[model samples]
Target: MTGTTWDILLLGGASGIGKSRAAARLAAGTDGFIVEFDDVVSAVQAITTAEHHPALHHFDHAPDTARLTNDQVLALQIATAQALEPAVLGVVRNRLTVDTPALIEGDYLTPAAAARAVDDGQAAGRRVRAAFLHEDEPEQIAANYATREPDDGDQTERADVSARYSHWLAQQARTYALPVVPCRPWDTLPARIREAVD
Candidate 1:
C-alpha cells in the first residue's frame, strides 16, 4: 500500500478508529480515489425501502441508539455489511479496468467479507487487498468519539459499542487471515498498516 500500486484497497474497522484517515493516506500515497462506504450506504438507502432491505435502513428511523443493545447494534451492522458485501466485490472487480485505483472504506465494509472478496479477486487474477483498523482502548475510542462529535453526549455508549465491535472485527479478521492493525500514536498508523498488509 505504501510503495506499490493496487487495483483496489478495502479498508474496514469499527467506527471512529480512523479508517477514513488511513484510507486518505493510502489514497494519497497511491494517487487513488477514496470511496466512502457511508455514501454507498446512503445511495442504497435512497433507492430501496425498508420493506425490501431492512438492514440497510435499520437505524434510519431509529434516532435513539441508546435504546438498542450492543449485540443488536452489532448484528445490524453485520447484516448491513453482508448485504453490501457483494456489491462491494462487484465494484472492485469492475473498477479494475479503470486507470485510477480507489480505497473503498467504512464500517459497513466488514473485515472478513472484504478479505474474502480480495481473495476472490486474487483467485481470479486481480490485484486487490484489504486491512482492518482496531483500537484496543475503549477509553481512547470514547475520547475520539466525543472529540469528533462534541454535541453527542452518548460517546461513552458509542464507545462501548465500537469497542465490542472492534474486538469482534479483529476476531473475524484473524479467522480470515486478514491483517488487523492497531490504530494509535497517529503518526505510525500508516506504517503499521502498510507493514501488516505488505
Candidate 2:
C-alpha cells in the first residue's frame, strides 16, 4: 500500500443541492483534495475526442446528443467508468500524500460503487464516510435549474429530475445507513457540510 494516508468523503444527493459547493468548502477548510465527477466527465470527453473514432464520437456530447440512443448513452457511461477506474485508483494510491481527507462529489456513483470505495479506503488504513444532501422543496430546485443558461451543458428542462433524485437519495440513505444532511437557503450549505464533515 502507498504510504500516503487519506479519507474518502463522498457528497452525493439531488442535483443543485449544493454537493459541489459543499465539497469546495470542505477542501478549503480542511486542506483536503476534491475530486468532482463533472471534471471526470470533462476529462473523459477530452479523451474521447483524442481517440476520434466514429463509434466513440457519440460520447462527445454524451446524453445530450440527440442522435445517440439510450443504449448508446449507457454504453458510453460504462466505457467512461471503465476508463476512469484505473485513474481513480492511481489517485487514491499515489496522489494523496497527507493525512487530510479526500472529498469526492458526485450524484452518479452507485450505492455499490460507493461502498466499494469506502471498503478500499479502509483496507488502505484510511477513514471514509458518505453523506447524502437533500432539499425539501422542489420549487427551490426548479429555481436553481431555471437560472442556468439555455446552452449550458448541464441544463435540464425537467425539474422532476431533481425531485426524483431526492427520493432516490433518501432511499439510498436509509438503505446504506448514511447520514442525510438537509440543506436549504443554499448559502448556508457550506456550514452544513463543514458540520457534517466534523
How high is the lDDT of residue 81 in model 1? 75
Number of the predicted model whose TM-score against the real structure is largest: 1
lDDT for 78 (candidate 1): 72
The C-alpha stretches of model 1 lying farther than 4 A from their native spots are 60-64
Q: In candidate 2, list every pair of residues with a backbone clash.
A: none
lDDT per residue for candidate 1 within 1-198, as digits (tens), equals: 336545677888989888888778766745678888788777888999988877667776567866888888777777777788766777776667676767788887777568777877787676788888988887999888888888978677778778888888888888888888889889988778777766
Backbone clash count for every predicted candidate, in the order shown: 0, 0
lDDT of 1: 0.79
Provide the lowest-lDDT 10-residue window in model 1. Answer: 1-10
Q: Which stretches of candidate 2 lie over 4 Å from their true place?
A: 1-6, 45-100, 148-156, 185-198
